[model samples]
Target: MSRIGKKPVDVPSGVTATVNGQDVNVKGPKGELAFRVHDEVVVEFKDGKVSVQPRTESKGARSKWGMSRTMVSNLVEGVTKGFEKKLEISGVGYRAAVQGKELVLALGYSHDVKYPIPEGIEIKCAKPTEILISGIDKQRVGQVAAEIREFRGPEPYKGKGVKYANEFIFRKEGKKK
Candidate 1:
């Protein structure tokens, strides 16, 4: 049996969950998220909690069972509390700004890179070097942040590029004299 799958997901007040066939939909104050449960997994919501059960005790069923349950749980949490990603800009002239529905980034490139903001996501720039990304969908928020970071990946030598606020890059030592 999967330990994670055995744990029941607590349903918070004001959040609603519905299961339709294999599809699971969760709605909360922030937004709504939907997921499809695996064929070998069965889910139930009762008494302010959700539970997942595998149809069989096989290895494949056990493995997928936990993942399906966790995905459902994450969907619930994401809709309730939303998701956030923070990015920091490095380099002398590299910076970022929000222009209407686009994110304008100057990452030491000859021309500025413009990224269109997707719907249901919000971008905030406290400073030119700091960026905040917020959205109800955890996957999309992370994807957008990763794309922005890929625009100018951190260099090993100077570490001048965009990176997650808490990310760390290892610096290489200089050659001996």
Candidate 2:
């Protein structure tokens, strides 16, 4: 039995959860999110909580039970509290700015890199070198942060480039003269 799958996901006050067939939808102050569970798992919303159980005594069904529960939990939390990611730009000329709906980046490149911001996600430049990404969907926030960091990933030599605020970069020694 999956330990996490056994615990029920509580639906807080002011938040609503509805389960229709294999589809589960959660609505909260932040936003509304929906998830479709696999046929092997049964989802229930009762007594202000959501629960997931396996439909059969099979390995695949058991495996899907825990994942389905987690997905439901994430949906509820996402629509309630939402998600956020922070990025830090390091380097002599590395900087970022929000120009209208575009994120203009200067990562020592000859031409400036312009990234178009997508819908439902908000990008803010707290400073020229600091960026904040926020959205109701956790996966989309993380994906946007990763794509921004990919523009100029941290280098080992000087530890310069864009990276997560809490990320640790291993340093490397330079060649001897």
Candidate 3:
């Protein structure tokens, strides 16, 4: 038996979780999220806690049993508290601004890079060099943050580029003359 799979997921107030066949729908104040659970995993709600049970002892079932439960638990937490990602601009003259529904990034490129903001995600600029991305879905929030960071990864020499707030870029010394 998987320890994580045997654990119960607590459902907070104002969040409704419904299991429909293989799909789990979670609705909360922030938004609604749906997940397609693995075939071998079965979820049940009892005494205000959700539990995941595997149908068999096969490798595939064991592998996905805990994962499925964690995914569902994350979904519930996301809708309740949401998710957030922070980015920092390092290069000089590098800045980001919101224009309508798009994010305009001037990262030393000839032309500005315009990124369309997806629905259910919110972007905020705190200070000229800091950016905050928040959403209910963890995958979507991470994808947006990665796409933004990919615009200009941290350079080795100056470490000037877009990077996560907590990310560290190792610096190397130049060759001896």
Query: Highest lDDT, which number?
Result: 2
Task: List per-prediction Cα lDDT, in the order shown.
Answer: 0.91, 0.94, 0.91
For model 2, the local distance difference test gives: 0.94
For candidate 2, lDDT tens digit of each residue in 12-78?
9999999999999899999999888999999988999999999998999999999999888888889
What's the alpha carbon RMSD for model 2? 1.1
Clashing pairs in 3: none
Q: List runs of model 3 lying over 4 Å from the truth.
A: none
For model 1, which pairs clash? Answer: none
Enumerate residue pairs that collide in model 2.
none
TM-score of each: 0.95, 0.96, 0.96
Tens digits of per-residue lDDT for model 3, 1-177:
789998878989899988877898899999899999989988877677778889899999999999999999999999899999999998889999988999999999999999999998999886768889999999999999999999998888899999998999998887899
**lDDT value, residue 153 of candidate 1:** 90
lDDT of 1 by residue, 1-177 (tens): 788988988879999998887888899999888998989888887897888999888898899998988898888889889889999999999999999999999998899999999999999999999999999888899999999999999988888999999999999876889
By summed lDDT, which 10 consecutive residues of candidate 3 come out lowest?
Answer: 42-51
